[model samples]
Target: MTPAIPLVLLGLLDAAFSGFRAYAGSDARIRKQRFATRAGLRGLAVGAALLLAPTLTAALLLVTGDQARTYNTLAAGGLGYLLPLTVYATAVLLSLAAYFALPFRASTLAVVVGLGPLTLLRPLAIAAACLGAVLNGGGGSALLVGTIAGAAVLCVEPTVHRRWYHHVQ
Candidate 1:
């Protein structure tokens, strides 16, 4: 089992990057300069995370040592960890693409932004990534539970956002 410290740190970094990207993308037109910087930083952060994933996982394994069951599970074990990383990476790319395309596709961006708030998406991504970490300690069932929970959140997020935004507007 990896120590809680590294996992918490990783989660914090993930959440920060995710939050930046979602916020920048959502308001790129209003703040192009800030959006560009944020996008660049987010790209760098995601790249570094992917590059160091193996090393970090190895280090966690070393720190934890090969003990009982679920040793080295999160980092080196299965698709559980990798899947969330991939999802996050893909989301970053897609969000950037959408931001870039927003000017040419205002309707599309509007529809998307109208459907759900970008703010919520950021934390959802973080939650998914943390669930991936849970795979390290808990196992496949943890990943499954995370997936289900995430799906539930995703399903309900838009309605909550829409209602809130409607009132604000």
Candidate 2:
């Protein structure tokens, strides 16, 4: 499968985790049980919204000519290499958005916290992608992807956090 699919799914899972947490807060489980379905569905929506840029970027890249690409077949310096960087950038942007908008809603906070596992691995993912691309004799495209991905992932989080609060509230 394409690497993009997994990244987007990870985004979905992260959001779903947060959604469940939002509903199951400091209350009885039975009380919040009814909201489970709604929460899960909404989580998917939120995940889509949050990862829309990267997901769409991946789709666009694939449609343009990278359709045959898979993680295993990702050629360095090719358009396919951009997917990881884009995912990384999207995540960074979200984080930056949140950092700048501190003291957000607890639910939004929960979403941020819930992404802990994926967030932790993002750096490694990007590093490996970039390093592998370079070692594979990649050139401008790979470098460009890394630069932009680094910029975006480092930038989006805080922005999304601030904006997402308005939605959750």
Candidate 3:
């Protein structure tokens, strides 16, 4: 199967989980319990890893090129590569921590704290970058699928959060 398949499946699963949480009508506290399980952590890890793969690969290319002098993929003399790598790497690490390391409610809160502001900006930019990559034959379908998945998450999460928090207060 293509690499995009996993990303697509995970994206769909992510959306499904968000939808489940929305319809489940559980309070934020209880919802955190549901989402912070071992299984849920694994899912979050996988999804986060997938989401960051393309940008990481790009950064790795830059590192490898510097070490081996084989090729440099960091277009625009590294400016293009550095920006996305730095931003995405930071976001991914925090997202992993928020979902995997932190406790349930705190994890949910952590994502809000970390990503709430950049929710629209980051996902949209990444989606646009991925589309550009696909059109320019830069990354691949997997990266495109991942960007789409990330965008889907950004779009749906606020509603999920609202649903989760609705009964809390």
The candidate maximizing lDDT is 2
Please list the residue runs of candidate 2 whose C-alpha ends up more than 4 Å from where it truly belongs after superposition: 26-29, 59-169
Backbone clash count for every predicted candidate, in the order shown: 0, 23, 0
Instruction: Please report, in order, the local distance difference test score of every candidate based on alpha carbons.
Output: 0.47, 0.52, 0.48
* Model 3 regions lying over 4 Å from their true place: 20-32, 35-90, 98-113, 138-169
Q: Among all windows of ten consecutive residues in candidate 2, which has the lowest summed lDDT? A: 70-79
lDDT computed for candidate 2: 0.52
CA lDDT for candidate 1? 0.47
lDDT of 1 by residue, 1-169 (tens): 4343343444434434443444443442654776555544554444344434434544454466554443445433334544565666566556656766678577467546633354446556646665655655556533543344334323332332342222432
Give the number of colliding residue pairs in candidate 2: 23
By descending TM-score, how would the candidates be arranged? 2, 1, 3
lDDT of 3 by residue, 112-153 (tens): 776555443555555554554444333443343335445545
Candidate 3 accuracy as lDDT: 0.48
TM-score of 3: 0.35
TM-score of 1: 0.39
Question: On residues 34-77, what C-alpha lDDT tens digit does candidate 2 reach at each position?
Answer: 67756656656665665655445444554665455532234444
